[model samples]
Target chain A: MIELNDYLILSGLLFTIGLVGVLRRKNLLMLFFATEVMLNAANIAFAATSHYYNDLSGQMFAFFIIAVAASEVAVGLGLLIVLYKRHGTLDLDNLASMKG
Target chain B: MYEQIAFYLFSVLIIGLFLVTVLTKNVLYSMTSLAAGMVLIAGIFFTLGADFLGVVQLIVYVGAIMALYAFAMMFFDVTKDVKENNTNGSLIFLLGGLTALMFVIIMSAPIMSENIQALYPPMAGVTNPQAVGMVLFTKYLVPFEVAAVMLLVAMIAGIILAGKKMDQSLTTEDDVIVEIDILEEDEK
Candidate 1:
């Protein structure tokens, strides 16, 4: 039998992978992708908990998270395009014009 | 028995595909893997009997979101490899490991408690979608409407931001080169 802990563990592992991507990647698009992975990880945890506990709240939270992620992507990708247009490169190191 | 096998299989596939999504240098490869991973995650939702959520995941994440990303990717040179400078590998490992450990401990803590009870348990005869609709309409109606408004704002913002230079072809823009040169000089 697959325990609830197993699903939680999987969620944790995926979250870690996403964190690594966020920390290590320099490409702005890849960073956004990493955030998406983290969001999905949280969704898994919430959905699994909802399933095991027979609660609708966790799934509802997951639904809201999805909605927020969609909006985030819309705004974020727009910002990315603008930034890319100005900078000509997506490298985080190169985009560091605000470094004091 | 079948659930166990399916769960294990989907778990492995989902994790592996996400790893590829995170670690791959090629954006195309990463995008493809992420989409596949998302589809499998919907499969996981289905396995958990969240039939409505599974379908939503399929339609939203795999269909709408990924398609938006693929469309946006057209503005960039997808053939070029993404270059990253990892100056401190140990710091990343240490941070990632610590966060992972913390997440695992906090998430699994509830599993040991064994006292959690469902607040809104599903009706015995109701389908997953029906139950979700009932709770959503009655309890979450306001938030759903708010989410719709937020999406509308985001759409307008995206359109305004990206529509600035819509007439200029990204690949064959002489002014873009001139602008980059000016910006580089400003930096120097």
Candidate 2:
């Protein structure tokens, strides 16, 4: 079994990769995937820490996070669909038209 | 020894698929990779002794939400979105450096160094899945109900909004095409 500290390190690395993806990727869908990566990284950390602490609350919180992620994807993708129909594309550069 | 080997294997799959999720130009493929990443994360949760969460993650994430994403992709007719891919440049390197600095700071945290043995002590033998279900259904019944309601609302909204696109795409294609042909004939 891997140590909890090692798990934390893994979580941290995953989150950073996710952050990089979110920052660098211009495609909204890719960014959404990146966000999922970050959320899962946090979820892993939460569950691991809870395991280390012997508390049920962490796992419970992770459940809540999972619920929220599900809801977000549902709504967010719905919006993305609308955006695609309007803009004809998903590039962030083109998304600027909505700003001004 | 077995644990280490398993950890390495899973880690390779986790990180490799994660990069694939980020790098793949195809949105559908990206979503698939994301689903795979979620499943592997659930496995991580299992290894961490969070059995309830691990199963929930798999069910909710890989099963439900990934399907939802795929369906939305189909509904949207995302033919244009795939064409305008942006190449990520220095952002990855910069974010890597920043996160490294963060890791250094996090690793050096006094609280971490203080050794919270009081935290998760190893209960390597017990199965607590039933215990969590009991708590979720009994103690947290109200919140659970509310969450179910929230999920219903979100689900309904997603259906309604996505439904609009299908309706629009068909109607606009039919109506607009007829209107354009008539306008062109009238002009001539």
Candidate 3:
């Protein structure tokens, strides 16, 4: 049967994939996408635990996390756009001299 | 039996998207696929019975974050991403090995013996959302407000950065002239 351990295992794999993207992709935008993968992995685990205990707290925490993630996207996208217009690209290797 | 089957199916879906998010060449496409993976995770949440989070995951993640990704992508001239697409397969294996090691380290920690670690049965009425809302609004209100405030700041910052582009680009006529001249000369 679909067990909690299975969900955790799946999330673990997904989280590792995100970590791989974050570690390997030199493109700033891809890094952002990877970060989203990681966030979703956390959400999955949160929901799973909440379901296991039949408690609302985990769900509530997930709710808050969702709200914050949305805001993070809004801001992160804006910064990315600015970087693109100014630098004409989104490679992380090229952005090291930023924030001056 | 059905639960086991569902677990395997969800696991494949999640893991497949996990790889896609890392391997796709196009950033926007990867982001969309990530959204798909998130919705599937939300389904997993539903399976777990966290209805509130499942719905919130849809509204906030797929709805909001994916849209923002699309918006950011629209601003870029993606053709300028000229580097050859390359990935280190050996590094991927290394990362995988490290993760497995870390997982083993975490899951094997000797907390109490299984007999001692087993908990009493949960209380009869502890499953509702109201109890959580009460705790959040009462005990965790401060951090909650801080998160909200952080969102507000992020929104303002995004708008400012996006808006500043017009002023800077328009005002920098001298910088554009030389670049325009070079482009025109090359076209001839």
Candidate 4:
């Protein structure tokens, strides 16, 4: 049987992969994608823990997370579109004009 | 036995697809792989017996959000190459790996000990959806409404941001035309 520990470990691995992606990637879109992956990792942990504890609260929390993620992606992608249109490139390094 | 196999399979698929999502240079490819990874995560939710959550995951993540990502990918001129210039790549990887290892060890420590136990036993008779709805509609009603409001605000904000970009582009085009006209008069 798959135990709670197994699920938690899996979530941790996924979250780590996302962290690596965020640190390594230079594309703004890919950064957003990595953030989404990290969010999903959190969701998986919440759902798994809820299952383990037989509490619906965790599931409810996951549901809220899903809602939040949806809104975040929508707004983020909108901003990304605006940024790309203005800058004509999505590379993170080139977007350092605001650096002081 | 079957659950274990399914869990491993889904996890592997998710992790692999996520790697593809982040590693690939093509925006469309990355979005597609991310969508696939999301579907696999929904599968994991199903394997964990959270049927409502699994379906919601499929619909919200794989269906709705990914469609938005695909649309955004198309909005950009993705012909230019995307490159990662991580100068201290080895150092970053080493640090990231160590951090992940530490996180895994800390998170799993409690579960490894025999003393850890669930506070409540799994509900036997109630269906997953019913149980979720019961709490969501009653105890979590305020948060639920707040989430709805948040979605509405996001929708309005997305529309405004995209629309503003369109206006800015149009104005910039006009400015470019006026600049060209002034240059032509100067030459004359």
- DockQ per candidate, 2 decimals: 0.70, 0.55, 0.46, 0.62
Off by over 4 Å in 1: B107-115, B167-188
Per residue, candidate 1 scores C-alpha lDDT tens digits across B89-154 of 889978997988887787677667887878888888999999999999988899999999999999
Residues B1-188 of candidate 2: C-alpha lDDT, one tens digit per residue: 77677667777899889988876677777787788888888877777767778888888888998887777677555554365544556766686659756864775485467665543333455577866776677667887788788889888878887678365577778999999999999999
Quality of model 2 by C-alpha lDDT: 0.76
Task: Quantify all predictions' global Cα lDDT against the true fold.
Answer: 0.89, 0.76, 0.71, 0.86
> Against the true structure, whose lDDT is highest?
1
Q: Please state the error at residue B46 of candidate 2 in Å.
A: 2.2
Lowest summed lDDT across 10 adjacent residues in model 4 chain B is found at B114-123
lDDT of 3 by residue, A1-100 (tens): 5656666667677777887777778788888888888777777766675565554555556767777777777777888887887888777767778666
Find the number of clashing residue pairs for candidate 1.
0
Residue-level lDDT of model 1, residues A1-100, one tens digit each, is 9877788888888899899989889999999889999999999999999998889988888899999989899998899889888888888898778899
Cα misplacement distance, residue B36 of candidate 2 (Å): 2.1
Tens digits of per-residue lDDT, candidate 2, A1-100, equal: 6777777777777887788788778878888889999888888777877777776666776887888888888888888888888887777888776685
For the second chain, the TM-scores of the candidates in order are 0.83, 0.66, 0.71, 0.77
- Per-residue lDDT for B41-98 in model 4, tens only? 9888888778999999999998999888878878787766677777887776777778
Best by TM-score: 1
